[model samples]
Target: MKLRYWLAALPFIGIYSGGTLAASTTFLFGLPFLLVWNLIWMAATAAILAIIYCLDTRDEAAHAGAGKGVEK
Candidate 1:
């Protein structure tokens, strides 16, 4: 697999490991620790996805630019 694939998996790995770690902790601000942990991970996942999209878009644009003067 490519490096991008591994990079894409990072968020999931973080969520799983972080969640497991957070679950054993106490609550904060009267809210469940797990809830807060999951919410943070969700935001992180969104950011990661956005980064992946931007990278893919950039790659596509570069590829298109490179092919502009090519035949077939």
Candidate 2:
């Protein structure tokens, strides 16, 4: 949905591409890049998840406060 999402995907895409390349080329350096790429991707994913969690919590709190002022 956002550019951040697309940017976040790049590391994972690199990992997959690197892995495929490694299998065929069998290069030592390629393996390290793959591992690093995956690790970076995982970190990015964690950050995104944390942001989503915070946003949800904020929304819930806002709704609760708003509800207190309304009467049916």
Worst 10 residues of 2 by lDDT: 21-30
Each model's lDDT comes to 0.78, 0.63
Query: How high a TM-score does candidate 2 get?
Result: 0.42
* Global Cα lDDT for candidate 2: 0.63
lDDT of 2 by residue, 1-72 (tens): 865566567655655665665444433445565566567667866786676555456577888899898889
Total clashes for model 1: 0
For each candidate in turn, the TM-score is 0.64, 0.42
Runs in model 1 with CA error above 4 Å?
1-3, 57-72
Off by over 4 Å in 2: 1-31, 57-72
Clashing pairs in 1: none
